[model samples]
Target: MNTVSQTLGQAPSAHVYKNDVRRKLLLIVVFFILTVLAVITDLLCGSGTLPWHVALNGVFHPDQASPMVHVVMWDLRMPVTITAVLSGIGLAIAGSLMQTVLDNPLAEPFTLGISSAAGFGAALVIVFQTSLVSFLPVDYLLTANAFIFSLVTVLFIGIFAARKGLSVEMIVMLGIAVHFIFSALLGLAQYVANVDQLQSLVFWMMGSLQKSTWTQVGINAVIIVLVVPILLLLSWQISALRGFGEQAQVLGISVARLRMLLLTFSALLASAITATIGVVGFIGLVAPHVARMLVGEDQRFAQLMTMIVGALIMTLSSIVSKMLIPGVILPIGMVTSLLGVPFFVWLVFGRSMGRR
Candidate 1:
């Protein structure tokens, strides 16, 4: 077995255990430090600023707090921070699972057209100016709508990809084709949208937490809580499935059954965020790689570390983004893409350097 597998397989290979543990420990430490910095930076910046002491006092004791600070910190920044963190965690987990399942280093939420389909769904709602979703509570409706559309898109891709049983290459290609068709539809929707609708559509495309509320955070939290445990539980079996597709068939792993279940789960996870938050890329692609680099290739270790680092990166981005414009909020997708793109580019290029 490779060193990474050895570490994950047996309980007591000291070299494997110690190395894995140490790396995870370091990532946790880094994540904690980064999250704290992001929170502090977010609290300290904005169009209107708060004194550090006043903000600190507000956290521990609500009284004797500056009203402006209270509004900005408790109302504005707090929810934004939470949304960014949770969204980051959700996307990161999705990316890692996809790569493992497809056995492709480049398999990612966006690359496979999942995010594109999601963006198209959200665009249809905003561009059409439809109140179809008005029956739902306003705070959560958009996200719910986005999730529904995303699942629909996923279903289309899933059905197409399920020929002769499920194959990773087929699904990936199906996703790519679906993405192209949806991209054109989204453009058409944008073209017909009025100014207000256009603006809404544009912002959703950019992916920002400026409009986020704690209510949305609560909804996202519930979905993540529901979905993640199931994925983590399947980690060992998933690892075995890699490069052993036929072996999986022989061992009674219902290839089609597993694909359907996983696709539904991934659709829920991805669609929930897409409907609510628009399309935030990179976390789903970048976080998993960061996890693997830190803790080797074990999914159990990888998933945990990815969640931690994804939260950290998003929190940091939101926090730092606040400082960039003082009072104005930058769309978060811009920040993540900026940071995540270069790293991913390097990963694509750096593969030649990887030992086979």
Candidate 2:
């Protein structure tokens, strides 16, 4: 009788589990469809608004399309649209990994000073006309500098965290300190810059998709493709760490090593994107939470959803940037900041109230 009772009790739970999985899967598909629509909307809504048929023809049959349509679609809009998507994916994934590894809801590349560091690095090149790598072309000097500085900042933070056995809170505080330090340095760089240098530095810091190219798109794609599989392979361990560091360590997960690895990869993703397109904020912080809300905290599903949500948000932001000024495209970073600031406020207060 007891055995029968146990079996009957377990049956409902198994069925419920299957149902939950199905629901999550369905949500993923739904979000994916939404992302596709958002991408199409982005491709359609640029300055010289092409009709769907024209846009489709330009994309699919460039040879047959008018020269103007082909140039507008291929030479201009396509790279920007693709870059936004790739940047969103990269930032969101980096944010998700940082949050999970650090066990802090607010931890992300921007908040952790990685983006600021990259900006400062880029500013160095802009102000001094200096190349960190002698072999890099003049065009790539700023990018290389940004990437290297961002990497160095994260490595410093990771090493400090590992050596000091800092708590999550301490790690966040350290990041904040790093952020302030870099901001001050960036300000100093700007203060001494000439009119042209200042204008260029300010614009880059504001983030724009205007400078994106096929080469940048390819580089961003390769980074995302490489980093994602490594994270996926360690998803189970990451999910476990999200629960409790002590527990994860007990399970032989090497929490310290895992955290260091995540930090490095997150920095890599954030740095590469920031170097390529300047500092677009909040996607990292916002997308992971949205993904978690939709799919709970299973890293596998949450990470994938985070990428989709990030891409959707970014693509939508790109559309808004174009539409807001009619003829003038507002900086993409400004749009994201406007959207993100309110959400960030709510996130902070809501968490505080929940704690109380």
Candidate number achieving the greatest lDDT relative to the actual structure: 2
Q: Candidate 2 residues 1-356, lDDT tens each?
A: 57876777465777888899899999999999998888888887787767889998898899999999998889899999999999989989988888876787987777678878988898889997765674888888888899888888988988988899998788888989999999999999999999999999999999998899898999899999999999889888888888777578888899888989998899899999999989998999999998998998888788889999999899989999999989888989999989988988989998999931
Instruction: Show the colliding residue pairs in model 2.
Output: none
TM-score of each: 0.87, 0.95
- Candidate 1 displacement at residue 158 in angstroms: 2.6
Give the alpha carbon lDDT tens digit for every residue of 8-80 in model 1.
6566678877876787778767776877777666655565656777777776666767787677778886787
Best by TM-score: 2
| Clashes per candidate (backbone, < 3 Å) | 7, 0
For model 1, the stretches where C-alpha displacement exceeds 4 angstroms are 1-19, 22-26, 29-33, 63-67, 131-134, 137-141, 163-166, 243-246, 249-255
